[model samples]
Every structure is written in C-alpha cells, then in structure tokens.
Target: MENNRAALILAADNSPLQVGPGPDQSSPAADEVVIKVAAVAINPSEWKMKEFSYIPLKYPHVLGSDVAGTVVKVGEEVKRFKAGDRVIGHCLGLVYGGAKHGGFQNFTTLREAVTAPIPDAASFQDAVVLPLGISTAAAGLFDDLKLQLPSANVNDDKPRDEAVLVWGAASSMGSIAVQLAVAAGYSVITTASAKNQDYARALTGGKHIAAFDYQSPSVVGDIVDHIRSAKGVKLVGAYDCVGFESSTRACAEVLHELNGGGVLPSVLVPPEASSLPAGIKAHIVNAAAPGMVAGSPGAAVWREYVPRALANGSLRMRPEPEIVGTGLDRIEEALNLHKAGVSAKKLVVLL
Candidate 1:
C-alpha cells in the first residue's frame, strides 16, 4: 500500500509544501513511462515559482523538476525503455501544469523522449543532479547559443579555438555548462568564487577550462584578457547561469570587451530586453521548454546525450548532491535550504 503514497504538495503561492495524498498512479501514455522515484534534486526555480506564482498552476500543485528512479511502467509506444529500467528524467510539471508530470510525488510520469538510461555505476542521488542541470546547461549552450552538439567521446586532441564563458562556474548549471562546452571541443573560461576554482577545474575533466574569481572587481577584465591571450580563438559567447541583472550586465560587459564593443549572451533567466547594450543580443532561455517539444535540442539532451554521456563518463553527475534528508517528509526542509542558498553543490532528497 505504500506504493499508493503521499507527495510533498504545494497548496498555494508562498505556502509551505505539505505532505498529502498523491494522485492515483496513472498508466503511461504513448511515448511515456512511469517511474517509482528514488531521488529528486532541489532546484532554485521551485522556490521562486512557489513564491512568485509566475507559472500558471492549479491549487495543491507539485513542485520539482529532476527525477531519478526505476521505471515501473512503460507506454506501449515507448521503445528505448522498459519496465524496471533505471533512469533519470526531467519532469514537466511547470511546462505541462500537472501533478502527474511533477517529481515531488513517489511516482511520476516522464516523457520517453526526455528520459535517459543511467549507468549501473551511478546512484540515484548522483543521477538526480543530471536532469535539471543538464537541461539548463544544454538549453543555453545548444538550444539558445547554437553551440555544436557534444559527442560522447572526449576530444583528446588540442582544444579547439572556440571559447565559451560560463558565468557562475560553481553553480549546478555552471559546472555542467563548463563540462559540456569543454566536451564539445571549446575552451571554457568560467567564473566562480576564490574557493571553487579547483572544483570548477575538476568538472572540466582535464579539458581546456580556465576558472576565475567572479568576486574580484576586475573579473570582466580577467575574462577579456584571457580571450585576448588565447591566439586565434573566437569568443563563441557566454552563458550567464547566475541570471541577475548584475550578472547579465557583467556578462555583456565581458562580451563587449571580447568583441571590442558587442556580442550576444545567452541568459538562463528572462532578462529585461531593454537593459542590454548596443549590438548585444540577449537570448533568455527556458530550459524546461525543450522537454515539452518533440525533436527539440533540449529534448535531445535527455534522449541522446545524457544516456550516452553517463555510460561513457563524458557527462558527470555534478556539482555533486548534498542530500538534505530522506523521505517525502523532508521535501520542505530541502526546499528551505535551497532557498537559503548553497555553494557549488546541489540539494537533494532521497525518496
């Protein structure tokens, strides 16, 4: 009977998540699979959505986006996965507006197109960090910025001359972005605090990555100088994972210096379009949007890259999971901790 379980439910805007009777476990649809969730990662978007109520949602909505679990059911049309497969999936709760699509519940329905098989070596806690972070990073780099798709094989040859700047290198998204860009054969220059420089470099897996201190007053100049010093490299642009106006403006300033006056920057949060500098194109990316669409670059991340990368060790389960507590009861505690802020790590709950 425990399979018929309770979920950490969000009753209203700014309300604390309360455990309540979860929706009746539903059968998977064509191209869908149902999972018995083993772990779920906490993301900042969950708290922001709970407070702002920006995305349209019904009362007592479920809030979570990253799920890692064992597949319990598969739609007849599903081909890549079967019942009992271990997987990591991106939940479509905010995009689809349904509790069935959310990850806070014990059982969740995932689109087969947006689910990836996990390697046996990875734990649910480790794999849970992949879904949302991978989605956010891949969306910015591949979808909005149009960087070349990464291969599962690492390029051991000389690093390519293309360079990408990832602002906030220690955040979950920033760490993954650095790995992804480096895997795609671009030299990655990223910003973290002084403490995380080594950690950021570790995420790049011995690839061409340079980590700098974002707190320094001359951070922008540091990036510009790095670009200038690298001979024959074109600034492919930057991904601003921090997404505040200050971070966005700093990214734009780095680009302005990189181009001697202008460049386009891809941002994770929606930006005030008017605030951008001349010739600076700001692409505000919604990482969740790709999972909702078929054949989208964001969808390909889960469908193709994540599974292969995980198996081949090209994609890492990173920033690493800092498990707050166990069980559905701890969801609220994890959410508060996430809202309070964490450094260079992801908050997670093992269900």
Candidate 2:
C-alpha cells in the first residue's frame, strides 16, 4: 500500500493516536482484498489497547476492527469484489497482523469472508456500524451458540420452538444479535431499560418474545417466566451482550433455572467459572472467530445475507453512528470519548 496515513500509536503506553505514514504492506493474500478506508467505527478495545496494553501490541501499532470503504485492489481468487466497489470489512489488525491490517489507515486489507458489499443507498458511516457488531454477534449466535444461520431467501423460514435471551438488547452487540436470532427464525427474549424496551423490541421487527427492563430487580425472573409462559417455546441459550458480572450471572442463572444448564456466549470476557452456577458454560466471542472457517455462520451473514438484507431493509443500522469528526486525526478523541462511555451510539471517524 502506498500514500497511506494512519492514526497509530508510537508505543502502547497510553499514547495518543497520531496521524502518520502507514506501515508498508506487501501484496494481499489470495483470499484478501485491499480497501481504501472511508470510515471506521471505534470499539472499547481500541482505547484499551493503549491504556492497558491489553493486547501487548508491537510498537507504533494500529487498532481498528469496524471498517467501511471502497475496494482498490483484489486478490486473484477473490470472486465477489473488484476495484471501486463500496464495502464494509471487519479488519483484524490488532488481533491478526499488526499495523498493516488495521482499519485506522486509509488503506486496509480484509479477507473476503469478513467483507461485504454495501448498498449504494447507504452511507459509509451507517455501514461502518455493521462490521464488528455483526462479527461479534455472528460469532456468539452462529458459532458459539451454534444457532441456525440467517438468510436472505427462504432458508430457515419456519419458526423454531426455541428462544434466545439477549441481555442488554439496547447495546450495539445485543441489538445485532437480536435481529440475527429473529432472522434465523428463533424468537428472541431481550432486556433493556424501561425507556428503550420498545427500541429493543423494534430491532427484532417486533418478533421478540419480550424486552424486560434490565433495571428491574426481577429482570432475571421476568425473562425466565416470559420464556416459560410461551406455550411451546423452549429456552435454548442466552447471550450476555453487556458481559458485566451481574448480567453474566443473570443469563447463566436463567439458563440454569430454565434449561437446566446451557451454553452462554458473551461479548466480553466472562466471570471466572468458579463463581458461576454449576452446569453453566460460558464462551467469550472473538470477532475474528467467524473468519476462521469456510462457509461459517459469519460467512453466510456477510457473503449471503447482509447485502440483500441491507438492500431490502430487512437489516437496520442500529445504535446509529454518531460522527466524531472527519479524517484519521480525530480517532484519538473518538477513542477517548468512547472510553468515557457512550450509550446507544457508535463513534465514527470519516476519511
């Protein structure tokens, strides 16, 4: 890659993300495509990567996961994309290749499986919200939970007898999981504050079993009771999107009480197993997990479903994007703002 600039750290010492020349990149792998990044959404991990040296990155590293941009180069084996196509990619820079693969730069490389074309009607900022959220949720539902995959066609059209509980449905990852579960024909049970209950339900197109108030002390019982009240619906599993100890406990408790014990996939690292209820299993969802295999649930979502879903309005841009500023220079400010805490909005930097 040439003529690329990036918001990267000089050292992983709680350093600022400074704009500078990008790391040099060699030719892309056969399954990879190069993107001219136009917009990127920040994640908690991005800030933590510096503040805590959470990942122990190489010096002058770049950290980004959510990306939306135009294709500039394609590998010979890449069949779905070419130069000039608009797309969104789940860049694995911090987790995979150090600086070269990061999305903070104007140019980033993405594997075909984790990349998808965005409809022309959609803006980069709007589409940028999908990558990490979609990847993390897909890893939880389709990979970890091994739930059925979503579709743009008639696949899994019949509703199943099982239901899934999504804790903190108003959050970014939870919202995506809610829609994906409902789209896969499993009724979703979710939790949000009283004010956002309707918003969470709306994420499922009103197909969710219920959106309980998470602030209520009885939320766990409420979710369990609601799931039990459904005539034939079984509580198959739960995803703690918030991943806090309390929410994790709530989900595991629901699973143990309702399903007698089940697997729980969480967006954050779960509490220690010793502290959890007996028979409850927990999995930490890695956004990069889905790209590990061919024809994976993530593959189906990004390659087979998302494009058509976005085009037809079946999928929505949830926890809508709030533009932090234009250009890579603002990524530090965006990361700091995100670290301080943002509710119901994904911070974005446009280039």
Clashes of each: 0, 0
lDDT per residue, candidate 1, 1-351, as tens digits?
A: 135455555555487777877766566788888899999999888888888887778766787899999998888898898878999998887877487788998888887777899988899999898787777788888877888877778665777888998998888888888888887888988888999988888886656888889889998888898888888998887888887787888888887777744444454554666776666777667777567665568776667677788888878788889999899889888888998999989999998
Model 2: number of clashes? 0
User: What is the C-alpha lDDT profile of model 2 across 286-338, one tens digit per residue?
Assistant: 77876666667787888888888888888888888999999888998999899
Model 2 vs. true fold: TM: 0.96
Instruction: Specify the highest-lDDT model's number.
Output: 2
Error of 1 at 225 (Å): 1.0
Which structure among the candidates has the greatest TM-score? 2
Residue-level lDDT for 319 in candidate 2: 80
Query: What C-alpha RMSD separates each model from the true structure?
Result: 1.9, 1.6
Give TM-scores for every candidate, taking all chains together and pairing residue i with residue i. 0.95, 0.96
Residue 262 Cα positional deviation in candidate 2, in Å, after optimal superposition: 1.1
Reference-based lDDT, residue 261, model 1:
40
TM-score of 1: 0.95
